[model samples]
Each structure stands twice: as structure tokens, then as C-alpha cells.
Target: MSDPATSPERHPDAHLIQQAEVPPLDVDGVQAASVGTGVFAVATVIMAVGYDTLAAAGDGWWLGVGISGFGLGLISLVYTNDRRRRRRRGEKLSA
Candidate 1:
């Protein structure tokens, strides 16, 4: 006899699951990166303004953190924009 757990009768929805086809989602990475970069830029500005207060409060590193995040977000924005452009032109994206 077949194992009960492995038996076809064990799952009534197996056929439905096998026949289901999920469509791929179309996302705009450039837009997402732009939003992220904007947020980071705002944070960097806030941190810069509060640098003196933060240093006095022993949170001086927050300014650097904000700057780094803003920098990385900018990089991501550039990369995503390039990727979107390449995709639109039907170019093969580098892995």
C-alpha cells in the first residue's frame, strides 16, 4: 500500500494547485528608488541640522548614518534608472 501522507487522495486541491498559473508582477524599480532617495535626503538634512544637539546627546553618529543612507539611496536611484532605460530599449541586462 502507498503511504497515507503521499497518497493522491490526501489532498483534494492538488489538481487545482498544479493547474494554477500566477502572473508576474510589473513593478517600477526606478520610482521606488527615487522615493527612497528622497526620504534619505530629507533624513540627511534633518540630521545635519541636529548634529550639534545629537553630539551633545552622544548620538553624533546619526549624521553619518543619514549621509550614508542618502548616498546609497542615490546610487540605487541611478542604478534603477539605468536598468529601466536599458529594459525599455530591449537591451540585455548584465547580471
Candidate 2:
């Protein structure tokens, strides 16, 4: 006798799971990083422009937040670009 839990015939959604085959999309990490960095750069500029108003409202930390985000995004952009270049050149990535 087969266990009910182990039997695919008794399991709900078993057929659906077996038929699920999603194709992977080809994506560029460098492009994604560039977009993220651009967004952070814009946010930093907006924060800088609103610093005085935000400070008066006790929200001056927004500027620091923006700066940190932009800095991190820049780092990501550089890292992604380097990785993409290395990949194009067939270099093995360091684990």
C-alpha cells in the first residue's frame, strides 16, 4: 500500500507543479546597477535641495540617508560593471 502523503495522485496541485516550467529571462546586472545608481543619485540631489526644509522639520537625517544610499549604489554599480567585464572575458569569479 502507498502512503497517501507520498503519492502524487493523492497530493493536491501535484499536476500543476509537475507542469510548471518557467523560462529564465536574460538580464544584465550592470544595466540594473546603473538604473539603481541613477535613482539613488537623483534621490541624493533631491535630499540636498530639501535639507534646510527637512532640518527645520526635524527630518535632517533624510540627507544622510540619501548620501548613504547613493554611495552604496555607486559601489554596486562599480562592482557589477567589473563583474560583467570579467564575465565577458571568461574570467572565473572568485567565490
Question: Model 2 over residues 3-94: C-alpha lDDT tens digits?
Answer: 76677667564543455588755243777777877888898899898889999999999888888988988898888888878988999989
Alpha-carbon local distance difference test for all models: 0.82, 0.80
**Candidate 1 segments whose C-alpha is farther than 4 A from its true place:** 1-28
Q: Can you give the TM-score per candidate against the true fold?
A: 0.72, 0.72
Reference-based TM-score, model 2: 0.72
Cα lDDT of model 2 overall?
Answer: 0.80
Candidate 1 CA-lDDT value? 0.82
* lDDT score of residue 74 within candidate 1: 85
What are the clash counts of all predictions, listed in order? 0, 0
Name the 10 consecutive residues with the lowest summed lDDT in model 1: 12-21
Return the number of clashes found in candidate 1.
0
